[model samples]
Target: MNKLLFIALCAASGTTCAQTPATNPMPDGSRDMYVGLGVQSAPRWDGTGSRKVSALPVLQVQWSNGLFISGMSAGMHLSTDPVIEYGPLLAVQPGRDASGTGRSADGVGTYGPSLIGPVPEPLAKFDARPTRLDGMDKIGTRLTGGVFANYYVTPQWRLTSSLLYGAGNDHDGARLDLGVQRLAVDLGGQHHVSLSAGVAVANRNYNQTYFGVTAAEAARSRFTRYDAGGGLQDAHVGVRWNWAWSPSWMLTSNVQAKRLLGSADKSPLAERSTNLTVSTAIAYRF
Candidate 1:
């Protein structure tokens, strides 16, 4: 039941988005791994109109004991059933700063070297820019804990869900992601593509941390005070293409589009409600 297909899927989707790899059954001590590098073009932040290009690091590994690492998440499978998969998960949530530059967990090291460090300070604190988040408090990177479960409707289709907490500065943020994946679709030769669509829901704390603005912040920043409530956050769709040129070498790529909804979309920080992220890399199977 080795699900190699998810390797490319996770790589393209920003591994920190929180996903559980399919169960991989192997010899008592064997493992599977993939590592590579690529580039991604994505919005500076969740709702900003600005976009930036960053380096993407691809890494997915699963051991026979069920422990696995995919992008910025690590978890262990607890089920042996082919039709159902469950596991405890841990992930890193990227932080946000006044510069409107953050989101490190999009992929392993995709957001530059600021991954584990404190969010950078805004350089233009006195330059009242219309789009800058200056005067806002910096949100540091957080480690979230949760679980994931997936049910196979058939060999080619599956439903996926994961819940995680401990996001945001207060560490009270929580989020749930629900989605479905259409496994590999043969395109002849050694090429295949997978499709996925999903929606995210978050608690008030989670939404507020990213989208809300306090009175204190409003006094300094350009945005007025806003209190974001809990509800649907975003909807997304993605496609992954994998071309296995050889048994050990393959070209993997992904394109994902996401749109903010509810309070998140209406936030003053949201210069745009919709955005797209794209990445591609060449990986080696070991």
Candidate 2:
């Protein structure tokens, strides 16, 4: 196992999952990894007020070759500079069905095929619950390509941005995320906390697929027809705490709050414009 270290940040929202790992300088041919499971409570869907609890799987890894995978995202670090980092990125955008968003607590879904293969939606029993997406069309899982760049003013503060394309039912959707983070603040003993706040901007195709109600959809669903334009989709703030119990064991917990913006907040399917997602997991290093 690699030395005890903490070096990743990931935030999830209705529209996107942002995974940003700090650059780690490790020995050649070595790696650091963590894998575990936990639970998460989040809204049934993006705009729904109802919430559901499901299993949460934790996976984070970084190799000596400038490659890393955190949560559902994978990317390579091409910059050697200590102050700035940039590289190509690829991510799996979960699909959506009548029940809710394809990704469950464990990051599995079944609306369509994932480029990496599906993990099979587990909480299907939750389908019995009513959701605003009941009569909506199924959106396929998408493999999005993008780039990520981060600027560090110091080791503890960073500015982050990423642009990803290829989402939505038609696969023409795109999103850009911008945020600032205060990372790894020691709070006595083995506890550490990190904070972040960001905003996501999306294109018309993306917003429409997730929020708009077409005439046909309105006819079938309870919602009235509505058009959602491209713009700022949501703003979010998050905090994460890590408690290291040993060289190989640690508990990680996170809480995030998001509020829909612009047209996304006005969609008929949006029962609530604001929501919170909370999760906790225990991981073992390898």
Candidate 3:
């Protein structure tokens, strides 16, 4: 439930991509792999304040040694204690700068190019308003690597935390997340429900790169100049459901609500602080 894992919703694949490992541990000599497709609604830009829906792929692999891959993240387990899981973490932090330019599988824009673009113009303009907010500087993807720690207080209660440092030039800043999760898995393994609540923090550089407006940007976007500082960026809660339809087939879905915090909430680009994201996918396990 780390808020930094998605770009304005579903930009790459068909859905917003976020994966929380399943409740059961892997059998010592076996592995479990799940592949899913989900859709999530996110802000139009990194602080744009408005939201749209996008779909993306989801996957998670848990192997013998506690090594796991979940969506855009992978890490190794450092502890043998069944109650606590922690180790090195590597992840991709999604970035954004487009004003609805994201594409979907049909080769059309995610929000539909007809209303935005795939062309040289704005489809809808409000008294010369759309032109001013037409374009933006592109934000490249970032590769982040760091440490992750999680504690399981009980079979159904968990605490998750992570710290990552960005390696990409796009937004070379650090990010941190702290969250708690609760999972309910039926003894028959036929159903599952999960809830997670967390908050994410970004450093000054990260905040500025994504939310700050330089003079040139102000001139281009027509938004007044604004400088953003680092601190708590977002707080979110997620509710997920899973159903095992058969021995190897499963279905999953989730809804997440996120609210901008601190400077991220006050940025001129923000339209609203509360963004609701939802996703669903059918997956397979072997």
Q: What is candidate 3's lDDT per residue for 86-188, written digit by digit as tens?
A: 7887666564544542432210001000012121221222234532244446556666788877777776667777778873255477767777766554435
Candidate 3 ranges beyond 4 A from true positions = 1-29, 46-50, 100-135, 167-171, 185-189
How does residue 103 of candidate 1 score in lDDT? Answer: 41
lDDT pick, better of 2 and 3: 2
Q: Assess every candidate by TM-score.
A: 0.88, 0.88, 0.78
Better of 1 and 2 by TM-score: 2
lDDT of 2: 0.72
What are the RMSDs of all candidates, in order? Answer: 6.4, 7.3, 8.1
Query: In lDDT terms, which candidate is top?
Result: 2
Error of 1 at 1 (Å): 7.1
**What's the lDDT for candidate 1?**
0.72
- Model 2, 105: alpha-carbon shift in Å? 6.5
Task: Please give the distance, in angstroms, between residue 188's alpha carbon in candidate 3 and its true position after superposition.
Answer: 8.6
Ordered list by lDDT, greatest first:
2, 1, 3
lDDT of 1 by residue, 126-177 (tens): 2457455787888888899999888889988888888899999899999888
| Top TM-score prediction, candidate number | 2
